[model samples]
Target: MPLTGLLFAGLAHADIAPTESDWGGTGLLQTPSAQMAQEGELGIEVTHVSPYTRYNFTLQPLPWLEGIFRYTDIDNRAYGPAVLSGDQTYKDKSIDIKVRVWRESHYLPDVAIGIRDVGGTGLFSSEYVVGSKRFGPIEASLGMAWGYMGSRGDIDNPLSIFSSRFNTRPLCGDAVGGQFCSDDYFRGPAALFGGFSYQTPWDPLTLKIEYEGNNYQHEPLGEKLKQDTPVNVGAVFRLNRNVDFSVGFERGNTAMLGITLHTNIAQATPPPKLLDPPPPPRPTTPPQQPPEQVNWADVSRELQNNAGLKVSKIARSGSELIVTGEQTKYLYIAQGIGRAARVLDNHVGPGIDWYTVESTNESLPVVDTSINRHIFDDLLDHQIDLDDFQRSVEQDAPQPRQEEVLYQATPKAFDGGLSLTYAQSMGGPNAFILYQIAANYDAEYHFAPDLWWSGTVSANLVNNYDKFTYTAPSDLPRVRTDIRQYLTSSDITMPNFQLTTAHQLADGLYGMAYAGMLESMFGGVGGETLYRPFGERWALGADINWVKQRGFDQGFTFRDYHIVTGQATLYVDTGVQDVTVAVSAGRYLAGDWGGTIDISREFRNGVRMGAYATLTNVDGRQYGEGSFDKGIYISIPFDLMLPESTVERAGFLWEPLVRDGGARLQKRYSLYTLTDDLDSDNFDDNLQKITY
Candidate 1:
């Protein structure tokens, strides 16, 4: 599943029904209402009513914001030329958004304004302001709409009183589509739509009645649709928490059947760990035994197997024991911290006053935390509260230690893993979904703690390349558009093989450099540096790379396309809701000068939802269908579903189209992501784990 839901999962749903309309919105049979599902809800609905069948994917990214992506098929129309689309049905892609205006109270109704079919081919475009109210087990909705949903022209548009520009509805979208036409919204004519839904005596059944405004004579494609009566009726049956089934009679003449699947992401919880060992029981008595001779090897093994820490070094200064290691598992760094403290309490001698754990990744230290051993012992003996222990802890950037070294890790030269990978291509001319299944094998050879050599091999196990016939035309250098060729070039390919190294340049500064095949389509050398103040909510980073396009076969061969691309980015945690904004001005892969803005927020469940758009010097017409480059990405922590805890994440990126205008090279790693926990906000969010 795409992990793009966030924040408001458990809000009350008593005011209105959490139902989908025939058009796949939260409402009645044919029109939308002001009611909305709980935030963080991701839903999919497929509804069919005569000449149309619609597939809708909706996400409530915010409590008041709902975004929908729809794929509508016209059963009566042909897709395109036979060679390009075969016998596929006509398909239309559209985007819709609704923003809440007011919440329902004792007297006021819930209200919202919305636009459908935004920036797409002119079909099914409409705008409306809807309000819904609930009384007992029944909910009622009323709204005024313009454009296709209001083609009946029941009255003059309300906006016409302000200006004559709101009196005419000119054509929207370009010949090839994908353009937003603000002038077309709330223009032309207007009509009223209203509906009511009643919850039945039975728990799972709800009945609906809607009065639609569209007469069905002025369809966008000029096809004539029939309307027996404006009144439509429907019933929804809730099958489970995440699924709904419905049947409806729409236009008073057509039959509609639909199904919806909904899931709340912000409320996601990982399943119980059935395979891992439990934490050792807390000691009942305080430490009274005198200090004993310690076997650091046994302690290191215990730390690795029981605490999920790959212990590399153990040192002692006075009464403190400093353990340095990588976290091999546990997405919640707090879990590791608590386990490490517990493990050390049992393994170390009573002389130790503080237990410190310095967490690193590939040998580069990111966070150093210290816990008062006495406070932990007191808490174990019921003498101190967890809050007291929390107050006694300290965290900072990795510190320079003058402790006597007790043990150092032996070099483990190499490590690797293999897994099955799946990839997809959507909205193609010939096929809606094209995919490939492959075996992914990757390995890392450690040359030193701060340096390593890594590479990955991908071999196709199965694919449907013969159906992949669409190739977008680009006037600029094809940095990313030529993906189809690369996917089918050979059964086996090497996408990346880079040598990377990093080191701390100063107190809050870090730097990393890399060379070799940077990605599947590009090979280059680049370096990135970041300055992240340990207790600040902001950071600055910059990167520069000189890259050349790789051959289709993805071997040790390069094409004659090369460019110098670089960027200086500013990252800020807005603090309003954990939203991070990154603004970057850079030279793109096609030599276009532009800036990209990325906004993202992490939910309570460790899912990151974000969207980004890039604007370059290229004009919309020359840049083609999607205009500028834009995409949405989702990163889901593996621990959410895995039996054992791990910090790894599965990621998904989606774009409406692949164009060459504002493309950037995909880096294997970034300093910002590598040193994320070093930032004050992230570290603090998980800091209380020290007392767990």
Candidate 2:
């Protein structure tokens, strides 16, 4: 499984929910409905799951009752011409919604009643469970569920075997020659299963064991094969406030391997003191007299009266104009191209200027040699199919997921290189422009095909470093060898420069592009090597992007390597809060190629704070060796308090997928807090009102 899902495993209260719902989340733990209410009485739980990855978010909505939502899906799929021919494949999604009826505390047994697979293709089944009892160091629980089930045991296609080359027709083999195959692969009705779990009373460790199976409603389909008698066993260990681990295994017609994880949500593992809500908005007084009328012509003419300032109107629509102005302290606008927002804080200057420049005309660099020049004017857009990618990985085998890192910084040659250019109007429409010097170095590291996260991708321009590290049983592969060999032998270099442009094409629609090139490196068991062309190392593909805003502040982009990524958001005005929802699909065109989707929303009150859920789909290797690993993850930023001195945070990033996969998440989660450049000694003086 992808290591991302391991990010959420245990519960702070026990509502059986992960806490948040994110687009690219993965499920590494089970938060069953009945179990959620037992953990807490007044909490809410949100369960987010994908084809191969499942995520559960349970909370106490009340003190005595708990609400729960569980989402999980597995699209039965098969690849390779041979396997694909012998079986029928279809996408499947399972959703379970319920309200726990009770929890056995000191004297009584726990109970609950609710719907299972509620908003899904009903297997025509629901479950009722109860539990409470301790046998010395062992704790146990029992539960039963009844529902509609499907079984297709008698259907047999000839592709089942060790090699794809084998072709044995019924007439050519004993089993086939007998023509005994029956069309019974899909058949089943109501069934039963007893669920139970146990743990040591003295330690944080836990153990679980359970079996679920059923008898057919008609008769034996094929040769009276065993039913759904699946069994599972797992345990967890809380290493510290910042670290924890878990492992579990299940077997039957299908099997699963999993782990648990918990990390910082806020600066403290135990939440910080919630501050009292701010005072309500005060009533505004009506102006005693009408505002003084000022001559628009006089204001426009004043540009020339200012020190070395020049102003000219290039275009005009109605009340707005394409005005150009320049002075000793600032540069002029591009006619009607961009706009100017005011920030006249005395600490910085008289005011700040914002606008946009023509990127194609500004001489942008190429990063990936594989890509021709970025089609600057190419309007064709693409999107990542996260849902499809997740389904594909679940049916296939495991492959290496590509990871990269890079850095960049530009001098203050152009008003801190900030501009606000509006390409068009929507006020009619508010225009937007691309600003800020875009630069960064990219490093791509490969990991061993297992459940742990480890690798290194460093970008020199932005001073950003991404590291993925973890360990698993021998059954899983380790990435240490691959990373070492690549670093030692690869011809890839750092500081691959790139320039990005954020453009507003229309209302609720914006586009951005990043183009650059760098040296390409290849890695293997012994080491890595750079593929060269003529005597020069070949450059990687050009990194170009175009985004289409889906709403007031959300959009999706396509990188063109068979992947689609997008962002979603929810906004609230009480605190002027903003939440971001993001998703990524498809692999980097290498390794066990697949896609990942993540959904996260950010909340802010001047600073930044929020929780998110992420789901990732990779190939699985156990059932289908070489299968893509599937993963789910949930993470929250503990540090929203900005540093006092920092004019702008350079390399600091919280949007993990927006950063470089899991690298930024790991680093930000480690830091206690970031400080600013504002000196406390002068803080008091700056706060006093200024008089002319």
TM per model? 0.93, 0.30
lDDT at 606, model 1: 74
Tens-place lDDT digits, model 1, residues 302-350: 8898789999998888898889998887777777878888987776656
How many pairs of residues collide in model 1? 0
True-structure lDDT of candidate 1: 0.83
State model 2's lDDT.
Answer: 0.25
Which regions in candidate 2 have their CA more than 4 angstroms from the true location?
A: 1-33, 37-76, 79-95, 114-117, 120-139, 148-192, 201-204, 213-255, 263-692
lDDT of 2 by residue, 59-142 (tens): 232233333333332223331133322332222223333455666577766555544333322332233343434455544445
The TM-score between candidate 1 and the true structure equals 0.93
